[model samples]
Target: GGILDVLDCTFEGNSTNLGRAIYNEQGATVNVLDCSFDSHHSSNNKKGAAIRNHGNMTIKNSTFSGNQGARSGGAIYSEGGAMAIELSSFSGNQALFGGAIYATVSPSTMTIEATTFVGNTAAQHGGAITQLFSNLEVSGSTFKRNIAQAEYGGAIGVFDSELVVSDNVFVANKDKTGA
Candidate 1:
């Protein structure tokens, strides 16, 4: 278990094999504020391109743009964790699943508020976000121009999860699997 707090940071063009930028393990608590992650990437495995959280994470007033993943979670992979994202934006990220965010594990939780996701793309599913067997709440968010090619959930995908969504705007999102 660990405690980390990062504030007012700018992470750009960072790359790794699996889960780069910040890797939060189980039982760890991390807080990120006023940060910007741009053009960060992950390769040679299916994981997070910018951050991977397996514990607890809170991100506020942040921006993620142009991040790429070899497989899943172009910006974040939150598995078996509690994550909260507020007043953040994700744009132009690409992945095979969850173009911007991927979260899983039952009993794990995630909340999003006042966020924006735009122009993210996935080759398979969840062009912006994906949650499987988790609890997720999203409100006051905007999703635009996200694309899921040959798949489903152009903006968000929830599979066997508990979800509450309200006051969100989705525009121009496309899932072109059978279209």
Candidate 2:
């Protein structure tokens, strides 16, 4: 098959570039189901230590934990196209920007529902999510204990973009913008 289906996979203890656990780019698509990405890191200017997307990706019933990005998108990053995430958990991830997730200039959109982001940190902005020139729809999500050390939007950043959030919880997040 031309599709990569990862079920009950565990990714942990990798370091180097961003998305130490997985990096999906150049219009590739990945479907992760009941998997775990944990305790990954990057060196300088690294991003998306757990998962990176420059394509169309989908994650369902997965967990991301303790990932770190030297630059941005500690747990996950998306650009260029659409990404769908559902019933997932992002916890204990850290980055210089978008500690948990980053969605940037894409031709399409991103959708996230029934997800949880907790104990993540961004040294600059958007402790949980940074949305730039893209479209995002989030429903039934929760963000807790996220931190932004420098700029703003502890939980989310909607910059020159369109975002729709419904039935979500933002709690105990630290940033200048206060999400």
Candidate 3:
């Protein structure tokens, strides 16, 4: 109902129906610092293999790798509220939609800075990130070797959202639609 803080934690080989590593519900806030999430997996048709936020979340200096989500958001997912991510890394994540991160809901706001995403893959769109009806801003990040097996936006995909990207690097990303 309020706030939760996590620091210097390691989550390995976690499996769950949703939010294998962490889940923040509505009206709550979560702060994660210097954490590591590795080899997390969501159950069949579930979303958010590593972390899922429905309220407010801040992540700094975290690492997510080898996570798998059956539906979307292999590394992280935010459905509502505000989120801030900085100095984080995501690699080798896989999902049906967003391989690394997914943000949805009209009133949601997100900001990502100084992050790295590499070798992520998605079956549909947005091998790195996918947003829908949200306000998003990304800066000083790097995306490399990400792939979308079908559809467009190997690095990012937006649907009915306000997006702002600045000072980011994209390299060797592939998508079926050549985006």
**Which candidate ranks first by TM-score, i.e. highest?**
3
Estimate candidate 1's alpha-carbon lDDT, on a 0 to 1 scale: 0.92
Best by lDDT: 1
lDDT of each: 0.92, 0.85, 0.91
What would the per-residue lDDT of candidate 1 be over residues 1-179, giving only the tens digit for each residue?
98999999999998766648999999999999999999988988768899999999999999999999888899999999999999999999999999999999977899999999999998888999989999999999999999888688999988899989999999999898532
Per-model TM-score, in order, reads: 0.96, 0.93, 0.97
Query: For residues 59-177, what per-residue lDDT tens digits would candidate 2 score against the true structure?
Result: 99999988888877888877776789999999988888899888888575899999999998989989888888899999999999899888888888678889899999989988976
> Comparing candidate 1 with candidate 2, which one achieves the higher TM-score?
1
Q: Which should have the higher TM-score, number 1 or number 3?
A: 3
Cα TM-score of candidate 1: 0.96
Poorest stretch of ten by lDDT in candidate 1: 170-179
Please state the error at residue 79 of candidate 2 in Å: 1.4
lDDT string for model 3 (20-110, tens) is 7888999999999999999999977888999888999999999999999889898888898799999999999999999999899979999
CA-only RMSD, every prediction = 1.3, 1.6, 0.9
